[model samples]
Structure formats: C-alpha cells, structure tokens
Target: MSTQFGAASTTDDVLAGVDLKGRRVLVTGASAGLGVETCRALAAHGADVVGAVRNLAKGEAATAAVRAAAEASGGSFALIELDLASLASVRAATDALVASGTPFDLVIANAGVMAAPFGRTVDGFETQFGTNHLGHFVFVNRIAGLIREGGRLVNLSSAGHRFSDVDLVDPNYDTTPYDPWQAYGRSKTANVLFALEFDRRHAPRGVRATAVHPGGILETELARHLGEGEVEALVTSLDERNAAAGLPKFQLKTIPQGAATSVWAGVVASADDVGGHYCEDCHVAEVHEGESMDGVRAYALDPEKAKALWARSEELVGETF
Candidate 1:
C-alpha cells in the first residue's frame, strides 16, 4: 500500500475506513496545534486517546476542544500531565498510567521544544536535548511493558535534522559552544536515532517504531522559539525555492496535514512490518544526497549510532531497561 498521502489529505481522510476501536493512543504535547488535531483525528476514528500535556489548565482546554470536536464526530479523549524536561514528571505520569492498568497500542512522542535559548533541564542536561530526546527515551523505556505486542511508537522529528547529527562527545553542550539551532538539530536527529534503535532492540518484543518529519507545520509549539520575522523569512525562502523547482507552493501544513504521517505510521498495516524508516508527507522518504535539506542521512539512521545513543541516553537519564 502506498503511504504517500499528499499535503491535501486531512486526518479524517487518511483514517477513513480504518477502525481503531479498543485501541489506546497516548499523545504528548496535546495542548494545541498539530497535537490537538492528531488527538482529535484519532478519537474520531474510534481510538481512545489520552492527551498528555505539561500544563493542566491548557491541557483541560485542549481536552475540551477535542471533546467538542469528538462530540460532533463521535469519538472520545482524556488528558494527563507530562513534562518532558523533567525525568520525575515523565516517571510520575507513566506511573499513573501503569496504575490505571492500561496498555497503549500507540505511543506518540509528539511533545518537544525547539531553538530555545541555551539552558539546562531539571536533570541538568541541555534543555532541548533533555526534553526532546532523553525525556521520550526514559518515558518509553519506563513503560515498555505496557505497550501491547504489535504496538507502535511514532517519534515526531523534523527536516531540521539535516542541520547536524548528534555531537556524540558533547551531547549536553558541556564541552562545546552552544548553538540553539544546532542543539535543536541534534535533538531532532536524536529522535530519528531513537526510533531506529528502538526498532532494532524491541521489534522482537512485538513493538515497532518509526520516526516522522511532520511536514513543516509552522504553528506548532516548537515555533515559539523563533521570532516572527525569522519565521516569515524561513517560510519565504522555502517558498521561493519550491517555486523555482516548479513544485507546489511550500505551504505550512494544516494541523491535520502535518499529522497525517504520524497517524498513518501508528495504524498502517504496511508500517506494521517495516520498522526503522523515516517518513514525511505520509510516505517513506527517500534518502537525500550532499548539500541538501531533505530525507534521512546515513549517520542518523546508523544502527551503531543508534545503539551508542541508547547507551549514552541511559547514562544521561540514569535509566536502564
């Protein structure tokens, strides 16, 4: 089956005729933007979704919005607390979920911050690296048992991964000059590596994993770190380039469009048998070549790097699985 749904496909469109009854989906960063849309679409398709957000008030509002949308469309959703910057928070949330005795059929590592000013997480690692990569690392490991066999993990990465791979020697920025965008790139690269390694290690346990570049949805929380002018300039530059290539306008994806690849990865049977691939525009993206900003690079998908990253992550977060 072709996974190449275009920018025009809505969440409902990708999910049509796909039944998710009795399935449970856990989505982080569910307060607004694509996360809310992802949760809404999953609920609409008969999956019970848990929206995980850091702020309770915002999460409640987000949940209400999804509930309202679901009521009109016939679906269901709930909300929970999860702060990716703090290992304690990740642990507490997973503990609560375990206490509730629910096994997740899909776990979407969807919450992340981008290009924030140099800072450290509560765990003392660089904030972006800590939250974006390590947080999901520990979270998934903590709840590995609760994932149903044949379950899937969807890591929300970005094309910015083309900017740089992990600085293996100084992942925390302790030994290098900190560049915010580079740090963000490392974190995103980490996301891809995480999926690659997770699939290698856990696929045998019946847990499959994939990472996705959710197609440049501009309004997601990650954009908060960019100035308005910077955002405009970035979009404008991409637009002109796409036009020059005779491609469609480089439009910022709508929430549903942005989320299609991830939602598809979670439920697609074709994906069931294929793990460790990077996806974009709802398809397995082609590997790119020198001096271009697209597709998964070799090092980012390297099993050795993935394995090393997993080991470093265990040391960084002090968690073993």
Candidate 2:
C-alpha cells in the first residue's frame, strides 16, 4: 500500500472515506486517552464497537461521546467488564465473549500501565508485566477463535519499549532491582513480541496481528503515575538530548493523533504490510538500534524472543493457546 498518512494524522483523518457498517471491533482500555478516541473514530465510521473497560461506571461516563458518535453514524457501542491485572477477571470476561459466539473484525489491546511504582498483580506477577502483557496475552488467546478469518489484532505498545527487553528469567524482578521505566519497557516490548507471534500463528487463517506506538500524548490519565513536575522534566530532558543530536525537539501528540496509528493498522492499512510488525505514526517502523526515540528496536521483534516470551507468558498465566 502507498504511504499517505503520517505522524500528524488523526483517527478521523485515517478513516475519512472508509465505511465500516457491518464490521465489529473490540477495543481494550476504551475508557480513556487513545482508547476512547479510537472507539469514537471507528464507530463514527459505522463499526459496531465493543469497549472492554476495567471500570464500568468510568467507562460509561467516558464513552458518552463514543455513544453519540455511534448513534449518529448508525453504529453501536457497548462496554464489557475486563480487568487485566487479574487472571480470574480476564478469564471470566473472555469466557463470556466466547460463549456469545459473535465474531470480531478486529481487537485492539490498548490498555496498559506506564512507569508505575513497583508492585505485584493479583496473580503475583509484577504489576506492569501482568496488566500490560500477560493479561492481554491470555485474554486475546482465549478469544482467538472469535476473531474472524481475515481479522486483525492491534497491540498498543510504546516507543518506551527501547528502554529494555523482556527478562524472561526474572520477569517479576525476583533478583534484579525493579525500576519503573525498565519494567514498563519490558511490558511494552512484550506487547510487540506478542503481536509478532500471534500474527505468525494466526496468519495462516488470514488473521493478522501487529503492535503500535501511539506517540507521546500528555493530556491523558496515562501520566497520572508521574510525579507533579516529572512530565515536564522528562520532556525537557528529551528536548535537550535531541538538540544535542541535531534532531528536532520532542513533541507530544494529540489524543486523536496518538490513536491514528491504532486505527490505521487495524482498519485502513493492508494487513499484509502490517502483520507481524511494529507500527507508529500510522506507518510501519523500521528496526532501529541505539537510543533514538524513532523506530522499533530489533530485540522487540526477534522471532526467537517472541516465541520464548509467548511460552513464558503461558506458563505465568497457567494457560496456553
């Protein structure tokens, strides 16, 4: 496919002339930030949207715009309860979906925690890894059958994935000291690897999967874990580094811009171009090395690493797909 969209494109921009009247999409983390915008954009294009949210009350309140857009476009929006931090909740929610037997054209794993303080999930894994990766790992695999052939899965990874690779041996930081950024990086990297492997496993059935980095967007709840001035400080630091390297200063994206890539990869782009890859700014990213904030790291897309992480994830969640 020709590249027509770029970094500044919004969800609406990507879906401008697309029609989705008979399609169904499932978006996790649909209550806030990029998730909400993704749902709204797809629904506005006439897709039936199921938003999987952790808090029903919060989701209902946050998705009012989504509902209105869907109503106006002849689409529909509904919320399903799903808490990624707990295995029990993941199982229950997925089981119900599977029982419903309704097929989905796409699934977006957009829920995740970023730079959180050290903690563990209900199932005893590190908080970030558990919620961001393992939880979706099981959730998606459980409903893999519900995804129609030729459907797709878009995992919301991050540019932060360059910070570190997954530590399969010490996933919970059992021995190594825990650092919030590193933990978040590991989880984000796992997101990419998960997509890579899932695409490989399901591509034969015409179901594709890919991961996306939504670009930095500060006006969202994702930064709540940051200290009062930490966001500002981080941005300044990044700008300084970029200036030293003769690169443009770092800039944050709007929620719509951040969500553009997700919808693009899941709906607009050719599945063959995006399958088993990591995408950003509405395009497939190249494998880049070093400390730059632009492209996916090789380690994140290593097929061997993806396979290992998939196996380890199954072990951790006590489930296989």
Candidate maximizing TM-score: 2
Q: Where is the poorest 10-residue window by lDDT in model 1?
A: 289-298
Instruction: Indicate the residue-level lDDT of 214 in model 2.
Output: 94
Deviating ranges (above 4 Å) for candidate 2: none
TM-score of 2: 0.99
lDDT of 2 by residue, 94-200 (tens): 98999999999999999999999999999999999999999999999999999999999999999889989999999999899999999999999999999999999
TM-scores for all candidates? 0.94, 0.99
- What is the lDDT of every predicted structure here? 0.85, 0.95
RMSD of each: 2.0, 0.7
Please report, as a residue range, the 10-residue window in candidate 2 with the lowest summed lDDT. 287-296
